[model samples]
Target: MQPRRLALANQKGGAGKTATTLGLASAIAARGGDVLVVDIDQQGNATKGTGIVATEDLVTTADLMSRAETGALERAIIPTPWDGVDLVPSDISLGNIESDGSNDLVFRLDMAFEGVDLSAYDAVLFDCPPSLGKVLFSALIAADGVIAVTEPTIDSVEGVQNLITTLEGVRRRPNPRLVLDKIVIGRRRNTGEHIAREAELRNAYGDTVARTMIPELAARQDAHSERKKIHDFRGGRAVALQVAYDDLLDELNLTSSRVQEKGA
Candidate 1:
């Protein structure tokens, strides 16, 4: 099966983008699928959280950006601590990649992921930056789909409208095949505001809003503090996250071999 490349994004902070990326990647890989997580966030939370922080310099995304000349992207693909998973870890250099690889900008990521065809891997997840920056655009242009993460707030929804506008503009010219797989709602609460927001979102975006709701669980924060996924940690908090994200994964179709290949 052809790999599904998802640029998981949300310009706003605290939208559970990082947590979702880490949790889903691990959960999906644990199901006997080969996974490659491409992190383009300068903060490198995904890199640290996934235990690839020590693999800096040698095969980091920054090193690939430095030598995009040879059209060697595989050099950046690093084997993570997990057997079924790998990482295209990122650092601060991800921000400078666009300007650095100016002439080769359009095909930079495509060129980097050249040889090791994604068909072999079950999924390719791009942990995007928190802004509509260079790294975010590059991933959007290169990926098969974008999993837009959103919080239960009017402000975040407003940002999605703007993001969609920007994406629409890009689709008209640059990446013609870009598709939004689904917009995952993050940090949900049973509060009145959150309840109202969810209804508004469904009415606003219709089928784009996914059925799963990632509840506002403390486990997400607790897991982050330890640099471990919620599923990998112990205690009741960990169990809560597993239940919440399990519903999410089921909605995302990651629990099965079936996957919707965007831009197919």
Candidate 2:
């Protein structure tokens, strides 16, 4: 059986998309399950977060997107320092693909993975760019589902709605199998405005909003800066972040056993 491919996305920057992607990958690794993370964001935050720096010699997602062939992804896949997690790193050059005029440009990402076996992974996650551009569309076309990550803020809420609209379009044509799996509330704070916004989203999109809310904790950034998984990081409330990601993994049914159960 093939693992589920999901895109963690938000049209707004600072919505914790990369953090959530890495956190979930870390949680899966902690459970002895492997995951493949494909970084399609120009910022390369997810690439760096997984402890792999994209040197000029490295084969990246940018290269994969530029090609129109199969069997290329295997060579681009590299093991990360994080156990049980591999990555297709990305760099700023990915931004150039956005403006390409080729008619089949958006389909290249899915084509790149054709005939490749992904059963070794529990999940395949695409850390998408913070925009509804070609890069994001390419990921949506290739993915089985989407997890929209957003902050508990007005602008972020609007961004989630925009993402939903985009998903509807993708489903109607390019990728009818694509589903919006969940809306994850990330970087949540205890402030009054945040609390109100969170309530608004839950009431409006009930059940689709994940029950697990990722708190705005400094340890997340600290662990990222140190290039260590939150499960291994030891200070500044890292335990809280770790528990949240674990809960999210369970909620999403992303564990290998849980995924098998679902398929059964």
Candidate 3:
């Protein structure tokens, strides 16, 4: 089966885009699914979280995006410390793509995947940067769908809208098949404003907003710092985060199934 490529993105920073990517990947891996996490962010937090240190010898996301070699994507795939999870890791060098003036830069990622069989994996997750730029555009161009991760704050709601606008622009031309699969609310809190904003997002997006909300728990940070999957991490509220991600994965599976059924 062709893997479902998902771009986890939010133009605004601190929207828990990386956290969501790792969480979902971990959840999928725990369920016996193989996942490829392509870290398109310069920070490389996802790469580190997967316990793969970026190095000069490794073919990183920059190489995969910039090089036209037919085997680049295949060669970039490396096993992470976590079983059932692979990575196309990134580093600070990936930032150079933002400054490169190549006209086909946005299409490079799509080109890199051409003629490659990704059937070995159940899903491919792209960890996008926190900006609406070439990297984000490249990811969207290559992805089958997008999961816009945001918090339930005023700024985050605006960020989701900006991402929705960007997705619409991309779909109008380059990726007409791309869908906004989900709008997930991450880093949720019990604050009155956050509660109100959560209700507001649910009201506005209706079914598009995910039913699973990732709570504001320090365990997520601790797990990332220790380079352990939240499922394996024993920290503050780790089990709760794991359960939330499991629910998110179920929702994602249902969404994918519906899309497949519609296509059929």
Model 2, residue 14: C-alpha shift (Å): 0.8
Better of 1 and 2 by TM-score: 2
Give one clash count per candidate, in the order shown. 1, 0, 0
Could you arrange the candidates by TM-score from highest to lowest? Answer: 2, 3, 1
Candidate 2 — which pairs collide? none
Model 2 whole-model lDDT (C-alpha atoms): 0.93
Best of the two (1, 3) by TM-score: 3
Between prediction 1 and prediction 3, the one with superior lDDT is 3
- Model 1 / residue 136 / CA error / Å: 1.0
lDDT of 2 by residue, 108-203 (tens): 899988899998899999999989999999999999999999999999999999999999999999899999999999999999999999999999
- In order, what lDDT does every prediction score? 0.74, 0.93, 0.90
lDDT of 3 at 20: 94
The parts of candidate 1 lying over 4 Å away from their true place are 54-56, 66-71, 98-101, 258-264
lDDT of 3 by residue, 3-70 (tens): 88999999989899999999988987777677889999999999999999998999998997775565
Best by lDDT: 2
**lDDT (Cα) of model 1:** 0.74
TM-score per model over all chains: 0.88, 0.97, 0.95
Lowest-sum lDDT 10-residue window in model 1: 255-264
